[model samples]
Target: MTLSSSLLNAFAPTGTLRASINLGNPVLARRTDSAEPGGVSVDLARELASRLGVPVSFTSFERAAESVAAVTNEDADIGFFAIDPLRGAGIAFSAAYVLIEGCYLVRDASPVTRNEDVDREGNRIMVGTGSAYDLFLTREIKKAQIVRTALSEKVVDAFLRENIEVAAGVRQQLEADAARTSGLRLLDGRFMVIQQAMGMPKARGDEAAQYLREFVEDVKRSGFVADALARYGIEGASVAPATPV
Candidate 1:
């Protein structure tokens, strides 16, 4: 796709596109065995840069919030983020390119067998600080207490150490955590599906955002997203349908 010169300039004011890559979200990205960053988000960023005819540089962050902050502050030209109203204040989002399941984990002996059973009054849920799960649970969980940890990868450890009743995170992470640590079971179904999208600073203007939206739809329809997921051996994440702007 040939992006207009104006749109190209809007998305990459620094000449090279600096894409903020969040390594903390295993569902979106992770460091491979050789310590190279690889995942759906990485592929998308490269593809975006390719379309713009610009060189891409990656700014790696350990958490999603950090990635969002980079884009918001214009420290990075773009980032992959879970679309949320709170974050929308500074970032302009494309239609979501991926949907990842969010679920709960609890001790096998715990009485919570179903997804709905988690929001009850005495249950204390541990979530990654500033994650989509933490944001969602903060709004939806009226009765349950929320305990936040520094990283999504540490939610399981926090839960175990604090003896929290439930741990909330990406299903893929929670499933792996449940497997390595005995006696922890995932809730029957997912509580939420996080919408992962590409975003640039809102100051970049609407035209750039529109170009990004189109880029995302083309990537999904062109099979790049599915191919990327399969290439990474990722499971439980589905390509999101294009949403009209």
Candidate 2:
């Protein structure tokens, strides 16, 4: 019923799954002294913890770099974010819990309608630095000026100020930004598809990791996963039923 001494010493449970995580500042995670619950990332984390019968603790940082570092340093047991192979080399992952499409946020009056248009002439795209979208743009996209912003929120802000012609990020983040601000539109076209999962330390010997994976798989097996996305008003995220054990 309790974690062994070795396990306890490695990752002291805060009664539930102790996680040091952050949603991307503006969209996925937000921190405020206000009464609001901030974002869906925190909401999902708590839900997963409650189901797992563990208390969830968070070390909310302002950036992914900080969150990743915190997890690596054992300040947090897990990080809820997109999985990167480079980072995955050092972190373990539950099965991908969600898949999201990256999209374009263009000015309402812009002539740009597709990826082809950006390369033809004067156009600028704003992206979050170190984000998967940015990595893809730098690799597959050419001919446009790519400006790297600090985060999804910053990219949204820059586009709002007309500093960049377009912003690229997850649809949820962009649409959420648009919901709060005017004159921004999420273009109908998708730039990329991204898969998000829970992250833990790289050590494979940890029994808790298996529990984490099983817990995630169970969440998918149950109706809970899709319901959480629905509660967040996320339309595209759907979990397929689990296969036979």
Candidate 3:
């Protein structure tokens, strides 16, 4: 795609595309052994910068909310996030480029055996503050009380620390935590599917947003997203399907 000068400026006013890299979502981004940002989202950011003929700079955040804040406040030009209406108020999101499962984890001996048993009156669920699942469960879980930790990576630890009945987050994260900690197991099915997408500040306008949307669609169709997932050995996440014409 030939980007207009205006669109290019919209994406990289500082001559570099400042991409907000959220290390919170392991499926989308993570810290490499060198401690630099590296993952599918990082790859996408580099590709977008290359297509725009601009250098890319990464602004790392340990939490999704911080990443969203950077983009919404225009501190960064672009970010990867879960598609949620609350976040959409300040940002224009493309159709999802990846899909991740949101699951619940509990002690093996706990009574919460099924996904349906999580919202009981007495159950308290742990989640990452300001995460996609946090927003989702906040809206959907009417009965259970939500207890939040500072970050998604801390959800399992806090769940154990606070003695919460359930812990909720990305399926892979929960699975990893379960494997590391004895007596914990994920529920059989998922509660929600997180739509991971690229977004820019809403003030960037429709043309800029349309360009990003098309860029995401093109990458997904070309297998760039799938290849990146494989290259990183990321599992339990799938490339989002093409948007309908």
Candidate 4:
């Protein structure tokens, strides 16, 4: 059959995009209207979808690692993860979107109050499995015997129940749960910069790579990323332009 000019036009890409957010960040999560995506990552994802003239959809996941898997599995066109090279195996990353300092978790009654405190004590530090924080703990943290566990929520639970001395993870992750345990406190100490960004499956190489770079660049140039981060009380996170300084 001969192709008509109108037929070719209808088949053209509409710049439509699809994405998902990791809902583990309580600051960005809303329980009342759970269907709506309102957090930092969700805001950025929705903005990009709008800019691309696509209908945006929202979904939630229990962990960041699972969110990354959604992308590779094609459940989502894109998903965000804290920057980890190992996580990059099945997907591609844009420039980092935000960086948050990580710290240690201690009981309210524990004497451990600083980074050095964890080091001075016997093994107690535990981190989420396949997390950038875990990589940092292994390479840079000393003094605490680092343990990796899946289901970070459970990790915290185990720490509290199993008589573990200390646990370290993302700042937001701990802050969101501090109230539930009654006596848990996030010890004050800078462990590492947790940089996060969206990842796309490597199968869409050329198109995905271009889209990510442009998305990061556009957000930075417009000050949109900075505004979004600040709106969510995520200070110290800057939107660096893709251009060389």
Candidate 5:
């Protein structure tokens, strides 16, 4: 793909494309044995840079909020994040490239057996601070009080340590936690499906956003997303469907 000069400048004002990588979502990114960032998001960033004819540099964050901040503040040129209206204020997102489930986890002995029972009064739910599930549950869960931990990876620990009634997070993370800890299990179904997408600062203009949207659709259509997921051994997250014309 040949990028316009204006689009290239919009994405790489510093002469290199700076991508904000969030390690909070294991399905999107993770630290390899070499202690460097690697995963589907990293792959996409590199691909974008390759097309733009610029070098790619990553600014890694342990939390989604931090990664979003980097892009929103223009400290980084682009980022991957869950599509949320609150974040749309500063970031213009592409159509989602991945769909991940948001699920509830509770002690096996707990009375909550279904997704519908989790919002009842007196049930305190633990969530990662500023994560997609946290933002989602804050709006949808009217009765249950939300408890927050520093990172998504720590939600289960906080839930166990603090004795919260429910823990909310990505399905894969919660499933792994359930396996690692005894007497815990996931609810039968997901409460929500998180739409993960690429985003850049809204200041970059509508043309830039449109280009990104097209780039996302191209990658999804070309099997780049599915191939990346399989290569990374990510399960339970599907490549997002193509956007309607």
Candidate 6:
């Protein structure tokens, strides 16, 4: 797609695409051995920059909320995030490029054997503040109380420290935590599915957002997204459906 000068400027105001890299969500990003953020989101950022014919640079943040703030504050040109109504107020989203399952982890001896069992009145759930799992549970879970940690990666530790009934997060994260920490097991099935998408500041206008939407759809249909996931050896994330014509 050929972007007009205005669109190009809107998407890359600094003449380079500044992508807010959220290293918090392990499902989408991770710190490589070199300590730089890598994974599916990084691949998407590089591809977007290449298609725009601009250099790509990353502004790393430890939390998803920080990434959203960078874009809305115009500190960064774009970001990867879960598509949600609350965040959509300031950020315009592309079609989702991937789907991530959100699950709960509990003590091995806990009575909550299934995902549905964790939502009881007395149950306390720990989550990462402002995460897609946090937002979804905040809206959907009426009985369970949500206790939040500063970052998603800290949720498991917080759960253990606080002795919370359950820790809620991306399934892969919960799995890794369970594997490393004894006496914890992930509940079968998932409570939510996060739709991961690229977003720009709403101030950039609908035309720029539309272009990103088209770019995402093109990547999904062309297998670019699938290839990225495969290249990164990322599991438990499925490519989102094509945008309907």
lDDT of the candidates, in the order given? 0.90, 0.69, 0.94, 0.68, 0.94, 0.90
Evaluated at residue 5, the lDDT of candidate 2 is 56
Model 1 backbone overlap count: 0
* Residue 176 shift from truth in candidate 1, angstroms: 0.7
- By lDDT, the better pick of 1 and 5 is 5
Question: Pairing residues by index, what is the TM-score of model 6?
Answer: 0.96
Taking the tens digit of each residue's C-alpha lDDT, what string does model 5 give over 84-123?
Answer: 9999999999999999999999998999999999899899
C-alpha TM-scores of all predictions: 0.96, 0.79, 0.98, 0.78, 0.98, 0.96
- What 10-residue stretch in candidate 5 is worst by lDDT? 27-36
What tens digits encode model 4's per-residue C-alpha lDDT throughout 61-172?
A: 7667778888877667777777777777887778776667777788888888777767764767877775667776777666668776775555687677678888777776
Off by over 4 Å in 2: 1-10, 13-16, 25-40, 47-54, 119-122, 179-183, 204-206, 240-245
Off by over 4 Å in 6: 33-36
Find the 10 residues in a row with the least total lDDT in model 1.
30-39
Pairs clashing within candidate 1 = none
Error of 6 at 102 (Å): 0.2
**RMSD (Å) of each candidate, 1 decimal:** 1.3, 3.4, 1.0, 5.2, 1.0, 1.3
How many clashes (backbone N, Cα, C below 3 Å) per candidate?
0, 4, 0, 0, 0, 0
Candidate 6 lowest-lDDT run of ten: 27-36
How much is the lDDT of residue 174 in candidate 5? 94
Model 5 RMSD, rounded to 1 decimal: 1.0
- The candidate, 1 or 3, that scores higher on lDDT is 3
* Model 6: per-residue Cα lDDT over 1-245, one tens digit each: 57699988988988999999999988778887775579889888998899899998888899899999999899999999999999998999998999999989999899999887888899999998999988899999888898999999989999999989999999888888888989989888888999999999999998888888988999999999899888888899999998862
Candidate 1: C-alpha lDDT: 0.90
